[model samples]
Target chain A: MRTLKFLLRKEFRQIFRDKSILAMIFIMPTVQLIIMPLAANYEVKNIQLAVVDRDHSSYSQQLIAKIGASGYFRIVADPRSFRDALRLVEGNRADLVMEIPAGFERNLVREGAQNLALSVDAINGTKAGLGAAYLTRIIGDFNTDVRLEWVEPGRFNPMATIEVTSLNWFNPRAEYRFFMVPAILVLLLTLVGGFLSALNIVREKEIGTIEQINVSPIRKWQFILGKMIPFWVLGLIVFTIGLTIARVVYGIIPAGSLLTLYVFAAVYLVALLGFGLLISTFSDTQIQAMFVAFFFIMIFILMSGLFTSIDSMPVWARTIAYLTPVTHFIEVMRMIVLKGSGLADVSRQLLYEGLFAVVLNGWAILNYRKTT
Target chain B: MPLWAKTGKTMGAVTVTNLTKTYEKGSVTALDDVSFRVEAGELFGLIGPDGAGKSTLFRILTTLLTADRGTAGVDGFDVVKDYRKIRNTVGYMPGRFSLYQDLTVEENLNFFATLFGTTIRENYHLVKDIYEQIEPFKDRRAGKLSGGMKQKLALCCALIHKPTVLFLDEPTTGVDVVSRREFWTMLNRLKEQGITILVSTPYMDEAVLCERIALIQTGRILSIDTPDAIVRGYPDRLFAARTDDLPRALADLRANPSVRSTYAFGEYLHLAFRQNDTENVSGLSRYLAEKGHSGIEIKPVTPTIEDRFIDLMTRETTPS
Candidate 1:
């Protein structure tokens, strides 16, 4: 215990003395939190539309007005023919074009069916795919409106349809920031904690100070723990910085208890630091350790369900996502922060993180050798 | 002189028997069939060139490395099995400066003290003589200190634990001459306190400072004895020769069938003959003059440890 105390003291003194470490601890978290969420905005808005109404009927006008009123689209041009609307799309002024064929109201009344043509610019694939889907759904709703207005009780029998009124529970209107903020917090903590611990040990090795430590009477566990605790404390400081940015800059508040969030974060840091130290034990230089840490952290971030939902992935991909500790923490972070879940609600994920902490730390400590 | 006792008596502070180590699957032999011993309170030197495996032997004894094929012990503790005890009882300063560069001098000292489960306050007396010289620069980071101060700080850090044996590998390799002399003086002082010190160096002059030394080359121990004994074992009478043109004189001397060996030592060439006597020694002056060398001089000189070292090295290198 006395040995650990001195080691921690020495480690902390060096950490605070280093200019690069200080900059990484304070500046990196703030800049990443502010810039990443604003730039990573994925919600597509203000889609451009061109209209070609050949029939000039009130039905076509009403349809155009409804598309604009849905708040997803902006009608940029109204042309008399399909060729003119195609010009608008080709000129890049419109994202997609919608054309109503001639005699659309007469055909709809006589045959009860009509064809609506849609031409979308496919260069931006996501924008084009979503725009086409959105236009199709709006036209379907318009058709239902027309049938309700013109149907007579005795003239035609109408079949009942089911409707779903979706009540968004955690995030009303599903703001993207609430979902991204919690995960970003996890990413920043993992980066600061893992990198400092790994590079710190490898720096000692490269400078030949590790030989002195190896010959000393310090126990393996004491030395490893001494390395771990200082970086763990710095990681928490970075985490707090990210949270303040989320709360003040992004206005994201945790719906669950802060105590539970900290509990999960504390365990997650242990698992992550263990992983970093393991890489250091294998590597002899700081550059090698940094590269190894980057490979694993990149996998962790991608597989953590931070950018994409895990439920939509294939069986193999989902298995990989479940295996990483970050995935479990991200799930628990989203549950606790956005869903206002209590500790009891996320007990399964908590248990998994705890298991990861034990296994990774135990493996690293055993692999660290003082005699070789 | 051995102090005879500080706390307890032991057979040998360190003992190694037929130790062997190689790198890259026996392709590069670092230490081949080496063995030696250091009595308690004795200052022993491992003198050789840079790659003579002195550092490897020190590492093995310090428990930082394991020898592949022999038994070694430090302070009566086995280096392989009782390594923990050896680590606790021995102090090692590697050839390179290994103190934390970013840490202050005092902090590095305190850190190593606590690492061995002791405090600077408890063991301050052991390192007092060495540490006092460096105490004024306690606030300075170790990297910013001069080369000499760095070695002093390194020595203090190694001594803070107050172990039974101290291992210093090439501690004077890069130090200035005055600092090197001062360092050896400090070692003698530490020896007076009954600490067994094992020091290695490439400088032959430092060999006489230790009570005994083992001259090594190419991972082999050529000779191990007191410096006086090793010098007395010189086989043939040696002569120092110099002329206006020294290189030509060396070549001319080598051309003689009776000349056994000749090599430059500073401004003069030291020559050892197969059949050495006063008549041949005086006749060498006329021989150099006949070879067209001017201002020729020849005289018999007492052999130093280095003279014997070179003689042994040449004898082993040239095939019988």
Candidate 2:
């Protein structure tokens, strides 16, 4: 225990010596949490739409009114030609176009069928797809209303439609910021936890100080744990600052117990520190360590689904995502903050992260050498 | 009682036998079948060049590394089996400045002391003599200290544990001459306290200070003995010769059949004559004069440890 204390104190002293590191640990996460979520909403609104109304009929005007009333699209241009409608879309003035054929009212009355063409710029695929779907649903509702009015008065309607009332169980209204702030916290913890420990040990090796420790009475485990504990604490401190900012500034609080978050965070920190140690053991220079760490952190953060939904990913990618500690932690964090999930709800994720912590730390300790 | 104290021994000795270490799967032999022992309370020096495996041997004895095939003990404890005991009983100052550089000098000293399961106050006497030098700068970061002060801090840290044996690997290689002298003085004082010291250096001049020395080259021990004995054992009579035109004179002398070995030693060239060459001094001087050499002087000189080292190395490689 004394050995462990000594080691932990040494680590703490080294970390506190660098003031820039302190700022990075405490300040960077708050900025990311505040900025990223505000910019990342999935709901598409105020879409610029162009219309080619060749029919010039009452039915076409009514259909346009229905789309405008939905508040999802705005009729920015009324182009007389198809060419102008395409030009509006190509010039970036409009995102979607609607065209009503010349005989649209006559066809519906004489042949009981009519064609309405909708075109969308699919470059921003998600926004474009949502716009198209909203337009189609609005047009469908308008057509049903016209059919209902034309039917005999006071007749009973027999057709039924299934309605899905999406509750958005955890995050009602799907506030992107609430979902994103906790994930950013996890990312910040990983950045400080993994990169700092790796750079610290590799710096010692580069400066020839590792030789001094190897020859000391200190054991290998003592030295490694001593190096890891300070960074682990730093990780926690960053996580706490992030949580505080989320609560005070954004009115976001964990739905689950804060204690559960901390317990799992501790486990994830071990995994991160072990990963850093493993990198340090293989790298002989600080620059190499930084690059290697950057590579792994990039892969881990991207695959962890901090910015995207893992369920939307392909089957193979989802399988690979399960291997990342960050992925599991992000899920647990979101579950706690949004779902107010208890221990049972997050047990599977916690178990995986805990297992990662043990296996990685064991490997790191085993591979570490007391001598060069 | 502590295991070392329970033994009731006053000093520590190290024994290494058939010690071999191969790196990169037997392609590089850092140490090959090396064997030696340092007596209790004696100062033993291992002298070698950069890759001669002096550091490797020191590490093995310090229990930082295990030899591929050998049985070694420090202070009666097996290096492999009783590594923790050996670590507790030995003080090692590595070849580089390795203390926490961000910490103050005093903090580094205190930290290392605490690591050895003791305090600076308990072992203050062992390190007091050296720690006093850096005590004024106790609050200064170790990185901010000068090379000399850093060396003092390292010594203080190493001695704070009050170990029975002290191992220093090339401790004075980059230190200034004054600090080097001061470091040796500290080692001498520690030796007085009846501590066995094993120091390694590439500098041949330091060989004289050790009670016994091992001259190693290419991972092999060329000879191990007292400096004086090693010098005395030099078989050939050596002569230092210089002329008005020294370089041309050296060239002319090398061309002469009577000279066996020639190397530049500072301003003069140390030359060894063939054993069978019966030519008198005048004959060699006349030969130089005839070759347009002037103001030539030749005198017999005693061999230094470096001289003995060169001679031994030359003889070992030359076919009989």
Candidate 3:
């Protein structure tokens, strides 16, 4: 324990003495939290839309007006004939073309039905798909209104109607920022724990100081813990700053106790830093350790249920997702922060992280040899 | 010294038996069937140039590396099995300056002391003489210190633990002359403290400072003895020859029928005469004059360790 104290003192001294690393630890995370949420939004809006209307009838005009009023599109072209409308679509002046047949009004009164054609440009598939869906919904609503106006007092109804209303819980409007902010917090902590400890011993090796330590009487565990504890404390400090940014910049205060969130964070850092040290033990240089840490951390973030729902993944992917600590931490963070969940709600995740802490750190300590 | 001479007493400070190591699947032999021992409290030097396997031998004895073939023990602890005890009982200063460069001198010293479960204050007497020289610059980063000060700081850290045996590999390789002299003086002081010192060096002059030395070359020990004894082992009588033109004189001496071998030492040429020829001064003077060399002078001279080393190396490479 005495040996550990001195080692920790040296580590903290070196870390703080390097001005660039200090800035990276404290300032960079705050900037990334504020900007990443604003830039990473996946919700698409303000689509550039064009429409071609062939018939000048009141119904056709009303349909065009309804499409314009839905707040998702802009009409850039209106042609007089079906051939002209098709030309508008071909020339990139229009995204959708609506053509009412020549006998449209006569057929609706006499035969009680009419045919309309819609042509859409599907080059940008996602934009075209969303635009087309919106236009279809508007036309369906217009048809329903017409049918309702046609019904007389003795006319038969279409059938019993069932309407579905969705209420998005937790994030009521489903703002992508709320989902993104918490996950970005996870990434920030990961960068702190992974890179710092990964480069610690290998840096000593490169600079030739590891030879002195290797010849000393220090226990392998003492050396490993000395490198880990300072970074562990630094990781928590960075995490606290990230949470402050989440609360102040994004107004995302946690619903559950901060105590529970920190408890999980502390254990998760041990597992992560342990993995980093394991890489350091196997690598002979700092560059090798950094690249290895990057490979694993990238996989951890991608497979963690942050950007995509784990349940939506295939069986093999889900199995791999369960192996990463980031996945479990993200699950716990959302539960406690968004849902106001209590201890019982996150106990399973706590157990998993605790086990990971033991296994990874244990393996690291065992693999670290005093002799080679 | 015979291995059995010290066996009945406390085990020698360090011992090795037929130790052999190779790199790249036995393609490069670093140490080939090597064995030696250093008596307790003796100042032993492993004298050789760079790549002479000095660093490799030191590493194996310090318990940082495992030998592939034989066994080595330090302070009565097996290097492989009892490494932890050996680590505590022995101090090693590697060939490279291995102290933390970014750390202050005081901090680096204190750190090594703390690692051995002691404080600098407790072991101040052991390193006081050396540490005091650089103590005024205690706050300076080790990387910024001069080459001499760096060597002193490294020695201070190595002695902080007061180990039974100290291993210093080429501690003066790049140090200045004044610092090298001061370093040897400090080693002598350490010897008075009853610490066994195993030091390696490439400088031939440094060999005489040690109580005994093993002259190493190409991973083999050519001779092990006192410096005077090794110098006395030079096989043939030698003469120092000089002329106004040295290169021509050297070539002329090698061509002479009376000369057996010749080598150029710093300002003069060292020559050996054939056993059958008499080496009168006029016979050599007349020969040089006939060869177009002027102001020629030749005289008998004593051999040094370097001359003996060159002799052994030439004889080893050349078949009889």
Candidate 4:
């Protein structure tokens, strides 16, 4: 306990000593949390499109009006030829191009067939796909309108339609920011938690202070535990502050118990701190520790499913994903904040995270040597 | 039993038998079957130069490393088996200034004290002398302190726990002359307080301050004795000689058959006669004067610790 007290004091002093580190811990998170969620929107809106309306009939004009009224696309230009529409897309002036055949309305009226072509930029594949889906939905609605006008008011429909009623569980609004904010919070915590502890030990090694500790009457466990506790507490404090910003600024209140989130976060902090300790053990310099921590953090954040869905990942990748502590915490944070999942819903994730904490910390302690 | 109680004997004495440590595992032997003992309260010095294995030996003795083949006891506790006990009994200051740079001097001292399951107030006297020197900068970050101040802080931290034995490995290497003198003075005061000190240095002049010293080189002990005794045991008659042209004079003496070994001392050439017979010096002086060496002066002088060290090393490798 005395060792823990000393370590905590030392860690706090170190954190407070470097002004840039203080800024990274307190100020950067707030800025990133607030701006990232608002900017990183997956739901695309106001897609700019050019239309080549070769069929100048009232029916074709009406179809264009229907596309414009859908509010998903802005008809930025009405080009006279298909080539002009293509140029609009190639020149980056438009995201999509819609081409109407010369006799589209006449073919629809006489032969019950018409064609509309949409060319979308597939470089941002997901955005392109969403744009195509929105355009298709508008066209389908127009077809329904034409069919309704031709048939009697109470006529029986002969086609079978499958309706997909998607009930977005946690975040009913499907706010991507709400999902990203919590994950970013976790990333910040891990980065600081692991990096700071790693720096603590590596700094000692660099400055030659480690030799003083090594020759002292202190036990190996005391020394390591003393070094770890302060950072762990600081990480928890940062975690709390992040959650507060989510609640107060973004109005994102977790559906699950905040107590449960804190508990899980506490365990996760241990795992990260242990990881840092492990890095420090192998590293002889602060630069080496920073680089090693950076490498692991990149892998952890990528595999954590912060920006992507883990469910969509392949089975082997999913298995590897489970090995990362961040993965479990990100899932738990999302479930609690978006889905309003109770402890019972996230108990399995908590268990895995806790186990990771124990195993990693145990391994760190085992590998840490009193003598070099 | 309390953890400290269980390892109480570690503070009693340290003993090593046939201790050997090889760096690069057979490529270089840092400590080759080196064995020595430091009785309680004795200030033992390991005198050697760079690559002489002083730091390596200090590390092994302090329980910061394991020996390849050897048994070492610190205060009646085995170095490996009773490492915890030994740890509690010894304070080590490595050659480098290694305290937490981000932390203030007081914080460094407090942290070290707390780690040892003690408090600074409980053992203030042990570190009080050195601490007083650095007290003015107690609030200053260790990184911002001068090299000498950093050295003092390191010593204070090492002494904060009041261990029975202190192992300082080249503690004064980079320190200024004044700081070096001040540090040695502190060590003397600590010694008077009955704390055994094991200090290593490459400086031959510092050997005089040690109770006894082991002159080591290339992982071998050339000689071990009191500084005076080591100097007294130097066998050959030694002389310091200089002329108008010192370099030419040195060359002339080296060329003379009567001169066995000659090396440049501070202001003169420290030369040894090939034949220790008192008759050889006159012939060598007459020969130098005849060889166009003017203003030549030669006087027999008592050998210093460094002089004896060179002579011992030379004799060790000579075919005879």
Candidate 5:
């Protein structure tokens, strides 16, 4: 224990001695946390729409007004013909074009039906799909309004209208930042724990200091723990700073106990740092270690169910997702912070993280050879 | 209890028999059928040029490497079996300076001390003679220290644990002459403290400082004896000659039927004669003068370790 303590002290001294690394450790994560949520936002807004009105009628005008007032669409073009409206989309002035056929209002009043041709720019498939869906919803509401106005409201009811009032329980506003901030917090912690410890021993190898340790009587476990524990503690500190940013800037407070969150974070960091040490043992250079850590962290972040739901993934990918520590930690973070889950709610995730900590740390200790 | 348990006796500090190591699928042999021993409290040197397997031998004795075909031990513990015990009992300074460059000198020293399960105060006396020289700049990072200072810091760190056996692989390869002399002086002091020291150097001048030296080349031990004894073992008469033109003198001497071999050695040329040759000084002077050489002088010089080393290497590579 005493040996480990001194080793930890040396590691901390080295880490704190470099001014640039100190800045990178604390400042870079804060900036990334603040900017990534804003840039990676999924809520699509201000869709550009072009309208071609051939029927100079009030009904057609009213439909255009309604689309504009829905707050989702912007009327960027008012073309006199369908050809011009199509040109608007081709020129990138608008994302969608709506063409009302000739006498469209007269036909709708006389026959109670009219055809409206709509074309959307599908170059950016996601924006086009979502904009089209929103337009369809607005048109459906207009259609029902026209029907209710033409007939007596009490007798014209389409067989017992059912109202669907959707309520998002955890995030009522469906704010993307709430979900993203927590996941980014997990990524920040993983980056610190994984890359720093991965490069620790390899740096020793590069500088030739590893021979001094290898010749000593220090146990392999003691040496590994000594090399890793300082980074583990730094990871936790970074985690706390991330949480503070989440609470102070994003107003995200955990529903469960902070103690439970810290407990899981502590165990998760041990597993992460252990995995880093394992990479260090295998790599002889810092560049090799960095590349290997990057490969694993990339996979962990992508398949971690952070941005996409793990259940929606294929069975093979889902199985692989379960093996990544990021997946479980992100799940726990969202559950406790957004759902206000308790110990019982996160017991399964906690168990998995605990097991990972034991297995990975054990593997690192066993793989670390004092002799070649 | 054994002497190692009570007095930290390093009797038979290192022993290797038929030790062989091959790399790249048994194609390049590093150590081939090598055997040697060092008595307790003796300063031993493994002398060889680069790629002579000196570092390999040190690594094996330090338990950092394994031998493929032979057995070795350090301080009565088998290198392969009782590696942990050997690690605790030996201090190794590799060919490269292995101290943490980013760490402060004091921090590096303290770290090694703590790793050996002791503190700076506990082993201060052991490394004090060396560490005190660099103590004023103890707060400076090792990377910023001068070459000589770095050498001292590495030596101090290696000696911090007070092990029974000390292994230094080329401790003074790149060091200046004054620092190299100071380093050997320090080693002589450590030897008086009853620690068996095994040091390897490519510099032949350093070999004379070791009580028993093993001259090695091409993964083979050419000769293992005291420096004086190895010098005495050179059978052929050695001669040093100077001429107005060195290269011409060397070339013409090599062409002579009486001269066995000749090499240009800085200010003069050294010549070796075959044991059965009857060439004398006057005959050699006459030959060099006839070859358009002037200011010729020839004399018998005492053979140094380097001369013996060159002699042994030539004999080994002479396709016998």
Candidate 6:
């Protein structure tokens, strides 16, 4: 125990002595937290539209006006010919083109139905998909207006309809920042905890100080813990800074208990830092340790369900997602931050993090040999 | 207890029995059937050039590495089975400066002191003479220290715990002359405290400082003896000569039938004979003059450890 105390003191002095570490601890969280949420947003808007109106009828003009008034699409081209409108789409200046056939009002009044052609650029899938959906809904509303005018206008339309009145359960306003803030918080902790600790021991190995340490009577566990505890505390500090940025900048407050969040975070840091230690033990240089950590963290982030739904991944990927600790932390973070979950609600995730902590640390300590 | 408890080899502060190690799947033999022993409280030296397996031997005995097919012990503890016990009782200063460069001198010393589970005040007397030279700049970071001061600080850290045996690998390889002298003086003081010291160096000049030195080359011990004894064991009478053209004189001497071995040592060319015949001495001056040499001066000279080592190595590599 006395050896461990000395080790901690030495570790902390080294950590603070490095100016880069302090900058990373404070600056990284604030910058990534504020920027990632705004940049990674999924809300698609301001889609460019090109129109080809052969009829030039009042109904065609009215439909175009309604689409523009919706503020979702911008009319970038109003070509007289359909070929010119397609040219605009091909040139990438237009995202979608809407075409109205000749005699469209007459056909609609005489035949009680008309055909309208819509073409969307499928290159950017999300932007194209959302743009097409909005346009279709607006045209349907226009069709309803034409029918209601022929029947008894403004008198309930003589047709039965059901109103949706959708209620987004967790995020009532469906704010993207609320959903992203918690996920980003978990990611920051993983980076600072994983990369810093991974590089720490490997630095000693490169500089030959590890041989000095190894030749002494210091126990293996004492050395490993000495490398761990300081980084673990720094990880928590990074987490707190991320949370503060979330609350102050994004106006996001965790709906769950702070105590539960901290408990899970503390355990997760142990697991993550142990994993970093495991990599350092296998590597002889800082570059090798970094590449190994980077490769895993990339996989962890992409499969953590932070940006995509885990339910949508293939069976093999989903299994990996469940195996990684990041997925569980992200899930529990969302559950607590948005759903007001308690300890009982997140008990299973806490157990998984605890299990990871033991297995990873156990392997690190076992792999660390005083004699080789 | 029997001195050789397990291996039954010669027992001392450190012992190795036919130790062998190979790297890259037995392709490069670092230490091959090599063995040596250092008596208790004796200042021993393993003198060789770089790549002569000096550092490898240090590591194996310190328990930082293991050998393929031999047994080694330090302070009666087996390096392999009782590694932890051995680690507690020995101090090692690797060839490289291994202390924390980011830390101040005092902090680095205190940290190592704490690692051995002892306070500085406990082992102050052991490291005082060496530590005092570096203590004036204790607040300075280790990375910023001069080469000599850096070495002194490394020595203090290694000795902070007061181990029974100390291993230093080339402690004066890169130091200035004045500091190198001071370092040897400090080691002399350390030996007086009854701590067995085993030091390795590439410089043959440093061998004379050791009570006994094992002259090693290519993972083999060429000879092991006291400096004076090894010098006295030279097989042939040696002579030194200085000519206006030294390299030409060396070539001429090497080609002569009477000159057994010749090489340039400093400003003079040293020669050894195939037989203990002083009659050739006067004949050699006339022979060199006939080979277009001028201002030639020749005289009989005593051989240093270096001369004996070079002759031994040349004989070892050449077929007898």
Give one digit per residue, the lDDT tens place, for model 3 in B1-320. Answer: 44643564347899877888888888888887788889899999999878888989999998888888977888878888899898898988987888988889999999999999988999899999999999999999999999999999999999999899999999998999999999999999999999999999999999999999998888888888989999999998888999999998988888887887788999999987777356456798998898888889898899998888888877777856
The DockQ for candidate 5, computed on C-alphas, is 0.72
Which 10-residue window of candidate 6 chain A scores lowest in summed lDDT? A151-160
Residue-level lDDT of model 4, residues A1-372, one tens digit each, is 666667667777787888987887888788888888888888877888899888899888998998899888888999888888878888888889889889988888888778889999887787789989999998998888887877778878787899889987667777787889989999988987889889878888887778777776666777787777777877887888898899999898887788888888888898889899999988999999999999989889998899888899999999888899999999888888777788898889888977888888888888888787
**Lowest lDDT block of 10, candidate 4 chain A:** A1-10
Tens digits of lDDT, candidate 5, B137-210: 99999999988899999888888889899999999989999999999999999999999999999998899999
Report per-candidate DockQ. Answer: 0.67, 0.44, 0.67, 0.63, 0.72, 0.76
Q: What is the interface RMSD of each candidate, in Å?
A: 0.9, 1.9, 0.9, 1.4, 0.8, 0.8
For residue A87, model 2's alpha carbon misses the true position, in angstroms, by: 10
Give the per-residue lDDT of model 4 (tens digit) for B1-320.
22333443454355656778887867889888776667789888889889988888888878889989877777787888878887887898888777787788888888888878889999998888888888998999898999899889988888888888898989899889999999999999999999999999999989999998999988878887888899899988899888888889888888887788998999899999877787777777789889988888889999999999888888877856
Supply fnat for every model shown: 0.89, 0.63, 0.88, 0.96, 0.91, 0.88
Instruction: Write the candidate numbers in order of decreasing DockQ.
Output: 6, 5, 3, 1, 4, 2
Provide the lowest-lDDT 10-residue window in model 2 chain B. Answer: B1-10
lDDT score of residue A146 within candidate 5:
88
Model 4 CA lDDT for position B235: 85
Looking at candidate 5, what is the lDDT of residue A330?
A: 98
Off by over 4 Å in 4: A45-111, A142-160, B1-14, B235-302, B311-320
Best-to-worst order by lDDT is: 6, 1, 5, 2, 3, 4
The list of candidate 3 runs beyond 4 A from truth reads A46-163, B5-11, B237-302
Docking class of 3: medium
lDDT of 1 at B263: 93
Q: What TM-score, over all chains together, does every model reach? A: 0.84, 0.85, 0.84, 0.86, 0.88, 0.92
- Candidate 3 docking DockQ: 0.67
RMSD of each: 5.1, 5.1, 4.9, 5.0, 4.2, 3.1
Q: In model 1, how large is the Cα lDDT of residue A359?
A: 90
Q: Best candidate per DockQ, number?
A: 6
| Count of clashes, each model | 0, 1, 0, 11, 0, 0
